[model samples]
Target: MIELSRVPDQEMWSISFGGDCANVAIYCARLGLETHFMSATGQDPYSASMRAFLTAEGVCDDLLLVHHDRLPGLYAIQTDASGERTFTYWRDSSAARGFHEVEGSAQALQNASEADVFYLSGITLSLFDRNYRAQIAELARSVRARGGHVAFDGNYRARGWADPAAAREAVASMAGHCSIALPTFDDERALHGDTHEDQAIRRWHDAGVDLVVLKVGAEGAVVSSKDGTAERVPIAQPRDAYDTTGAGDSFNAGFLSAYLAGATALEAAAAGNRLAGEVVMHPGAIIPAEAMPV
Candidate 1:
């Protein structure tokens, strides 16, 4: 969990744990994957509680790197009458920013080597400084070069990037390194400017991505492969969404879970849609465990 605080101008809303990678890790665990979160958090009471929560949720804790001097990151979400959401973040000096900057970097690299798939997002990339960012990217490539799969989500937030060109370059460079692309069409449209889903898939395919799972919001998802094949998979059911938070992450969890278990890409996408539809009907990213499907 990300440990958030919600505040409004009239009443104030403050909430935490809206990070994309953390949400995926949590959902992966709930979906029966042996998941581990690789990120930095403060050694404070709140961070401790956050670790406790993940441990209680059955996620592995050995990979969680704790910083004693810094504090955990925080963000606030503001929702208006039309149900639109905006965010204000206070994470400039958060512990996670210093993740790859650790002294014994070999230890961090060793921890990363154990995961079957290293799932990360554009947000995770944006959190790092230049040198550390390159190191992380190299690590991701090394993971895949060794025959381990890498999954990427282009969870782009324009506000998160200091330089738009840097963001584009980073994303383009890393796109090919991943085995799976869990792309949200909305974000892809915003980043690349009005490209069709086919064009987007082609872009990744040309860059050497083996698979692309293009999420089209309520339209469900489309799967495309490098071998000139494509298919559309609709959401399992029509839904009136309550909140769309964590829908993509949970979808990644469901889809990856099914894929890892040997389901077809289309079948995995259906699982993703089923999970996402159920999530949007409830508030927050992590819904009740009992509500999850088999």
Candidate 2:
């Protein structure tokens, strides 16, 4: 979707390619991962731009499927005085929502089982109907069975679901097959009304997720595992954030980058916090390549 924000002298807009999983893939590639992104998009100017952007960012788009007759979705961001942004979307019939129906989707998903890790988010699930949700679950199961790690982020949006119960059910089912569960405390509270972080962690662990990384805003992130070990990774330093848009998403990229590179979960959480701290200081979900920590 397109992003618009305010500057000192006037309001301006910036458009870029952004979807949750795609966002992670971009950051991971920049962070030295051989990241491949798979998705469906229309054959439009924006879709063309997206493909080019993904390529220029060092992300592999070989699995991106093009729909002949549709348009990509668009969203607008409006920020408050506090820099917190609200969204307005026009994606009900976006070509990406029909990803399962895209010709190469099944093959691309099947091929994902061979990867070292597979990542997805609740927003990805919200694009599908009930049947496709089950298809995604089966794909996650396949990845796990083949000894590949499945990572999940419960990036929930109420507008994405038909009801709270279905959202909860679907998220739990996906969580059951994930080895790494990255969830935001605010989303968990909104979904299950859990009052504490530990409660949310237990729920994720109970669903068969072995490693849990729960992000709690500026408090940093909490890392836990099924082995009954847990630790809090506080922010390394205070940040003057301009936009909080992709903080959690980039956190996932940084944490996964560290974890897959053999860092302990606590270390990964700290890495995530460090990257997120940097991301929030920028105006969008992504920062310039030079802005990344050394």
Candidate 3:
């Protein structure tokens, strides 16, 4: 999508390519992973520019299918007083919504399954129809069944779901298939009303997640594994954060980068916090490439 983040008070807009999965793909590529993105794009100026942006960031765009009828998707972010954001999307009739309906969609999904890590989110599921969601679910399960890591984030947004029931179903499916599950406490509370954090944790574990990390803003992340081990990891050094957009996406990328490099789960969570902290210190979905930690 063509991302336009409104600069509060200044009435300025910073335009770029943005989306949760795309953000993760960029961060993963920068963190030394071979990440390929699969989606549909319209043959429009915005799509052209977004593709160029992805290429510039070293994320592969060969998997994108071109659509002639629909235009590209666009979203604008409105940041609040506390660096939180409210998003409004023009994606309902977007070309990318039919990504899995394209002829090459299954081939793309099957090809991506060979990856060492298969990463996706609830948003990805929400974008597609029932059949496509099934394809995604099956792909994730296949990845895990083959001993590959399937990383999932229930980056739930009620607005994206057709209804709360659909959200529950998709999120539950991903939770059941992921090897590493990353979820926010607020999202869990909104979706399931789990009184205690452990309730959410237990739910994911029971659903088949071998490792789960519950992100509690400021309080840091609580990490748990199927072996009954759990602990809280503090955030990395705080920064003068300005925007919280893409913080979770970057955290997942950083954590995956560290974890793929053989770090312990707790160490990976620390890595996630470190990157997430850095991400919030900047505006928009992506920080300036020069500002990224080495």
Candidate 4:
């Protein structure tokens, strides 16, 4: 999606490439992962610019499909004084919504099944129909069968669903296939009536998720492992955020990067918090590469 972020207290908007999965993929690549982003785009100028941005960020685009008859999705972001953001979307007819119907879609799914980790969010599931969503779950099963991890973040957007029941069913379906679950507490409370982080964790574990990382904004995250271990990992140092746009996405990237590097869940959560701290200090979803901590 093309992101148009309104400059805080200014009458200007800064344009950039940003989407939930795309943000995570770029951050994963930046964290030295061999990341591949699979999605669809149009033959428009904004699409071309997005492609260029992905290439420059070192994110592989081998499975990106192009459709001549469609256009890319777009969204605008506005932030309040506290740096919390609100968004307006214009993506009903985006090329990515036709992903399952694209020419090379079958081959792309085949290739994606061989990945070491398959990461997706609730927003990704919202983009497709029931059949394609079932296909995605099958793909996740195939990846796990091949000894890969399936990570899912239930980044629920109320506007994306036809109703709350539909959202619940869709998110639950994906959660069943995920070995690693990263969910925000607020979203869980809104969607599932999860009164506490423990409720969220219990739900994920009951759904067969092996690792559950429940993100509680500001305070930190709660990590639950399949072995019946649970711990709360707090932010080392919180900052007065400039923008909270990509905090969760960046945290997912950092946590996965560290976990894949053999760090324990607690250690990985610390890394996630550190990276997220840096991200919230910036104005956009992505900060400059040089600004990234070593």
Instruction: Identify the superior model by lDDT, candidate 1 or candidate 4.
Output: 4
Candidate 1 residue-wise lDDT, 1-294, digit = tens: 353433333465444454788888888888789998877788888888888877877888777887777888876655455333566778888888877655544587777866678898999888876777677778788889889889999888998898678788889878878899998888888888746888888888888899999999889999998895889998768787766778899999999989998998999999999998888766566777889876
Which regions of candidate 4 deviate over 4 angstroms? none
Among the numbered candidates, top TM-score falls to 4
Per-residue lDDT of candidate 2, residues 1-294 (tens digit): 444445434656767657678879989999899988878889988888888888899999887888887688877666666656677788898888877778889898888768888899999889888788898899899888888899999999999999999899889879888999999999999999999999999999988999999999989998999987778899989686777888899999999999999998898889899899998887767788999987
**Cα miss at 131, model 3 (Å)?**
2.1
Please list the residue runs of candidate 1 whose C-alpha ends up more than 4 Å from where it truly belongs after superposition: 1-16, 80-84, 103-105
lDDT of 2 at 229: 71
TM-score between candidate 4 and the true structure = 0.98
Q: Please give each candidate's TM-score.
A: 0.92, 0.97, 0.96, 0.98
Better of 1 and 3 by TM-score: 3
As a whole number from 0 to 100, the lDDT of residue 24 in candidate 2 is 94
Q: Name the better of 3 and 4 by TM-score.
A: 4
79 in model 2: Cα distance from truth in Å?
2.1
Clashes of each: 16, 0, 0, 0
Report the lDDT of model 3 for residue 246: 90
Give the per-residue lDDT digits (tens) of candidate 4, residues 7-41.
76689988998999999999999999999999999
| 10 residues in a row with least lDDT, candidate 4 | 5-14
